[model samples]
Target: MRPYNFSAGPAVLPESVLRTAQQDMLDYNGTGFSVMEMSHRSDMFHSILYHAEQDLRQLLAIPSNYKVLFLQGGASAHFTQIALNFANGFKRIDSVVTGNWSGIAHSQMGKLSDVKVHLAAHGGDLYHYNDLPPASQWDISPDSAFVHYVINETVHGLQYRDIPQLGKDAPPVICDMSSEILSRRINVADFGVIYAGAQKNVGPSGATIVIIREDLLGRCSERVPNVWNYQKHIEKDGMYNTPATYPIYMAGLVFRWLQTQGGVAQMEKINTLKAQTLYDAIDGSGGFYRNPIQPQARSYMNVIFTTGDKTLDERFIEQAAVRGLMFLRGYPVLGGMRASIYNAMPLAGVEALVAFMAGFQRRYG
Candidate 1:
């Protein structure tokens, strides 16, 4: 049996998706060409892209006003591209720093000479990001271009349970949902732009999915390159340049798998059960295992916990790997444990991890 993977990104994929990819590796749809070798402009690849978008739309119930673009450069590249695209005329962009990714995005936006990066809200101190500041406390600038926030902070294991209700007059909300996009249901119209790297929940590392309102398409800065511009991508149907064909195709398969499993609503139910099971293990460990994030903001995707001893933590990771529960180590910046239970992670995988955690705690507690 394959080991359960809990790595953050380039992470676990559904086993069925893997099997399908394996079967089609050398000859996709009897074309005698691997998807990796197929031309992005080919009719076969176009069908792959078309079905991927349509299935995703159907799964999310995405509004007609939104344009879904499959682009490359990962979510990091879009950090700069987002500023260039939407922050063109405005002098300031509001960013809420809840974890490492958002902090990086805020810093990247600050590198731009024209716009100011406003600190809208933060989880906690620089060293410990254990709690989310309520949206009511966010000091949003009224004249800012848009409000950018991460729906789920992968490293810190913090999540916003509900969408932030910024008043009607507030600027558009742009979100980076790299870790938890399709795992839950979100209204597409709630935000001006929603972008996620495909690695975590979608499929693989190369493709980045951007769902943007049609009106926001016209805001791309003239200085931005055609490849990085959203409007240019939308014009070509997300093919302004050669796209990440293999990853997109893989993502297409995952989308179909989601539909067969009864779609995002069903996935959310399973994901909730998995998260609650793991969190229950940690919380019920009698202080042997501890997760510092507040209960309300704890993530349903990434669950972070530590045994409070570095030696014990290392030993736990080592033994978990030996037992076929892999990648239980936390992010380097925050040293402990993080089990990223993305959509592809089955409940059985989570239950195995929980069993391992209980065994480790009993041995060392």
Candidate 2:
């Protein structure tokens, strides 16, 4: 049997999606060529791409004014592309430096263009990564092009329970929702741009799904590369060049699977139960297994915990692997243990992890 995977991105996908892909591997739609070998410009591919976009829009309740573009380069590439597209005419871009991903975006924006990047509200040592500062602490510029934040940080186990409220005349809010998208319901109208690498909750690593407000298009500077221009991609129907065809098809299958499971609202409920089951295991351990993140800020998607003893942490990971749990090691920066429970991770997986933690604590604590 395949082990339960818990890696951060390029993470688990629904079993049903995998089975469908396997069945269609050789001949897709009675066509002689496999989906991997088919010409992207063919009518079959167009139908695949069209239905994928439509299903995603319906799943997310994406506004008619928004444009969904599936592209390459993942979320990291968009860090530079975002500045190129949105930061041209504006004087500054405000960013919240909460964790690794958002911090990376903030730093890259400063180097990518002429826009004066503002570190709106950085969490200091006292509250770093484990908690989010109050919205009142943000030093947002009224004239900035946009305010950026990550909805969830996979490494540090931090998540924003609600969208941060900006000032009355605050600039548009841009989010890098790489790890959290599709795991729950969200207001698509609340942000100017929502981008996520299609790895964790969506599909595989090749495609980056971007949903941008219509008004945000056509704002790319002339100096911006054609490949990175959002307006150009929109004009070309997300097919300006060869897209990540297989990954897009895979994402479409996953979207259809999510629809069968009652969409994101049902996903949110299952995700909550899965996260709470693991969190309860940690909390009930009586300081044996501890998660540093505050209760409210803890991420439902990525759970990071510690054994208080480094050797015990190491031993737990090693032993868990022997029993079939995989990739339970924490990120090097966090230095303990992490379990990334994306939408594809079922409650049974979380239950198994919790049971292993309990048994390990009994043996080692």
Candidate 3:
């Protein structure tokens, strides 16, 4: 049996998707060439791209007004690209710093000399990165170009259970959903832009998915190069440059797999159960295991916890690896254990981890 992988990105993929890719590695659909070797301009690849978008639209119920662009450069690259494109003609942008990724994005936007970066809200101030502050307390500037926030923080394992409801006159809301995209249902029309790195729930590391409202497309600054401009890529149907062809194709297959599993709604239900199973195990362990984040803010995708004993935590990780529960070590900045249960992870995998946790506690606790 294959060990259940729990690494955060370039993470675990569905067994069936891997099997399909394995079968197509040499020749995809009898095209006499691997998807890796095919021309991006060819009709076969175009068909793959078209179906991928359509399937994703169906899954998310994405509005017609939103243009989905599959582009190169990880979501991190877009931190500056977003400012170049949207922060034009404005003095400042509001950024809510809830965790590491948002903090990085906030800092990246500050690098642009033209626009000032405003801290709209920060969770670390009061919650110490354990929970989010109430949205009502966000210090949003009325004239800011856009409001930036992260829907989920992968490292800190904090997730926003409720969407922020900025008033009608507020600036556009741009979100980084790298860790939790496609894991649940979201109102596509709620934000002006949403971007995610495909490594987690989507497909792989090379492809970045940006869903931008049509009206926001024209906001790119003239000084911005074609490569960094959202409008330029959208004008060419996201083919301005030779895109990440194989990663896009892999993402297309993942979309089809999501459809077969009854789309995001059903996946959300399963994800909820999987997360609850693990969280419950942690909570029920008395003082043996503990998760610091507030229950409401805990991520359904990444569960972070610890025994409060460094030696025990290390021993748990070591023994769990032997039991096929791999990559259970937490982020270095936050030393503990993290079980990232993306959509591709089966409930059985999480159950296996929980069982191991119970056995470990029994042996050591």
Candidate 4:
């Protein structure tokens, strides 16, 4: 039996996608070879990548003007790539610091150029996430590379419900939608660049998916290495270096599975229902438990809440783990429990988690 996996990521994949891959593992489409053993340049592999990119573009409704490249860097590598592409002629960037990941992004860019790490509105816990910096306070530059924000901060269980419209005063908007990409519907046209590491929401960890506006790629600073540059990957059709063939293949399968599930819009509806079930349980669990973000900014992907008593929280996780609820613990940077309900987590999975939480709360409330 599969346990309800709430791992932040490298998390859960749809069983159907996995099953299909398993079926095709040994003999891919009667080609007499495993997909794993196929050459990346083979016609079969080309078809896989071609369809994967097609599915992704359809899922996100990405425009033809944007280039979608499946690169090798994790989001961490993107920390430098973003700065590399934009900071060549530009000197500064505007970023919002919500949690550790964004904080690291802010700091990493600091090494390359003058990154103006704008202070954001952060409340103490999950209940206070909506406190955002006023639009008026956003330091904007007409020529600044881009403004970065995580639509969903996986660690803090914080989400920006609406993209902050900085009017025409700010630089182009760039987003890291790693943990929540396909879980909900996003206006792809709203962003200048959108990137995600495939592990969490896509399929596996090693591959990073970058969607960039075509015109922005060639402007990188001369100091930027060719391999790390977005234009290089774009020009090479993301095969510049040896790609993660297996993960990319799995991602393609998963993308096809997503198409069967009615794409991102349909998935968004199911996700909303799943998140609400879990959040409602936490909210109604009484003063015994507390969430850290404000109501409006609560993340549908990662639900972070704390049991007032640390010892009891530990016990709750321990008991839940034995019951087959796994990876419900918080990140080391944040000392609390987090339930990451990504796209793969079905409505039943969230329901199971809520049932477990209620039973746990009843015993220890």
Candidate 5:
């Protein structure tokens, strides 16, 4: 049996996708060439890339006004790219500092360019994730090209629950949907840019999907490097640099699989149930286990909780691993145990996790 994998990113992929890749590893489409070995410019690879983009557009209901680009450098690169590529000579951009990812992203943008961030929750000591910082307090300017927020925070298991309707005058919104890309439906037209590191819910590492409004592509400062420029990326079809072909291909496969499963809306329903199962188990455990996030902001993908005792937390992780549940540990910044139930993690996996947690609590409570 394949052990249940619960690592945060480079996370679990659908078994169906994996098996298909393995079968096609040596020969792809009877072309006598492996997908990894095919030239990116070749029609074969072009077809692969084209289909992937189409499937993603269909899966997300991406508007025709958006340009989907498969690019390199993961989400980290986009952190810098967003500032340099979209700020249009404006020194500062808007940020909503929510959790670890958002913190790192906003901090980078601030250092590299003139960036302004309104901290949404400072470590969220009160309710794990209380309501986000009220929108009125943030400094907003029309010249500030865009606002940014991470849709789902992997480490803290916190989410916005709903996209913040920044004030009417607020700049366009940008989101890092790395950990929760396809787990729920999103209105693509509502945001200026949506980028995701295709590791968690999409496929493997190395690929990042960037969707930017068509008109917003050329607004970057002229000082921006060609490689990071949104205009260049869109013009070259995300091929301005050698792309992460395999990761993009796998992402395409995953998109197709998601479509087969009835796309984002259906996945959202399944994800809701999975998160509820695990959260309910923890909630009903009489304080044996606890999630820190506010109920309203709790993440549907990353479900993080604390055991209250350090030693006990260690015990639970070690014990959980022994039982074939792996990578339950949380991010280093936020310690405890975290269960990242991304798109590929089925309800069965969550059920197993919940049952084991209940059994462990009974013994250790």
Candidate 6:
């Protein structure tokens, strides 16, 4: 049997998408060349790119005013791109530090001498990963370029349940939804830019999706590189440079696969069920397993818990691997176990993990 892979990312992809890619390895759509072998500028490749964007738009209900750019850099690079693009005129960029990803972005923004960064709302030193600070307390400045926030923190297993209310006349919200984008529905209008690293839920590494409001494109200063300029990429239809062709093609396949599964609403329902089942297993373990994240803030896609003993945690991971469940190890920072159940992870996989958890607890408890 194929093992259930729970690596944070470059994670699981849809089985059907993999099978389709395998079938198309030699010839795609009756063309004598594989998608990877075809020229990026070819009419056939153009169609592929076009349909992919359109399908994604339909799935997310992205507004006509928003531009979706499939860029080359990973999500981490966006921490700099966002500031470089939007922090030119504004005195400050307000960022909410909820967990690891947002904290990194906030720290990066602070290093830009031209841009003053405001920590609008932070989980603080004590409660950094357990819960999100209330948005009402955020000190977002109206004149700030953007109020950046992370929708999900992969390592900490924390997530925001709804769009944050950052107060009236607040700057446009920028979100790093890298880990949770398509797992649920989100209002595109609520954000000035919504960016995600494609490795989780989308397709794979090397491609990042950036959906930005039209007006935000040309806000970059002259110091920003041409390749890093959102306006330049927009003018070029996200093809200014040689794009990650295979990753984008795979993303298109993943998006099409999402359509067949009844879209994001269905995905949200299934994802919620999976998280709840796994969390329930942890909660019901009678202290054998403990998830540090608060109930409301817990991520539906990544579940982190521990048996509270490092040696036993090691044992659980080893035994689970032996049972064909793989990459159950936790992030070094978190120091526990994590089961990252992205969109491609079916409920059956979660059930299998829950069963494993129960059996492990019985043996080790």
Query: Whole-model lDDT, candidate 6?
Result: 0.89
- TM-score, every prediction: 0.98, 0.98, 0.99, 0.94, 0.95, 0.97
* Alpha-carbon runs more than 4 Å astray in model 2: none
- Per-residue alpha-carbon lDDT of model 4 for 268-324, expressed as tens digits? 899889888888888898767788677887899999988978788889899989999
Q: What is the C-alpha lDDT of each candidate?
A: 0.91, 0.90, 0.92, 0.81, 0.84, 0.89
lDDT of 5 by residue, 188-261 (tens): 88888999999999999999999988888768656778887888877787788888888888988899999999
Between candidates 4 and 5, name the one with more favorable lDDT.
5
| Cα lDDT over the full model 4 | 0.81
Models sorted by TM-score, best on top: 3, 2, 1, 6, 5, 4
- Per-residue lDDT tens digits for candidate 3, residues 122-212, read 9999789999977798899879999999999999999998888888988999999999999999998899999999999999789999999
Q: Which residue runs of candidate 5 sit more than 4 Å off their true CA positions?
A: 114-131, 134-137
How well does model 3 score by local distance difference test? 0.92
- The candidate 4 region of ten consecutive residues with least summed lDDT is 119-128
Give the true-structure RMSD of model 3. Answer: 0.8
* Top TM-score prediction, candidate number: 3
Model 5 superposed RMSD (Cα)? 1.8
Model 3 pairs whose backbones collide: none
- Which lDDT tens digits does candidate 1 get at residues 291-311? 998898899999999999999
Please give the distance, in angstroms, between residue 72's alpha carbon in candidate 6 and its true position after superposition. Answer: 0.8
How close is each model in CA RMSD to the real structure? 1.3, 1.1, 0.8, 2.2, 1.8, 1.2
lDDT of 5 at 118: 45
User: 1-365 in candidate 2: lDDT tens per residue?
Assistant: 77889888789998989999998999897996789998899999999999999999999999899999999999999887898998888889988888888888888986768788888888644496679876788888778999988989888899988777775788888999999999888999888999999999999999999999988786776687788899888889988999999999999999999999999999999999999999999999999999988899999999999998889899999999998899999999778999999999988888889999989988988
Residue 269 lDDT, candidate 1, scale 0-100? 99
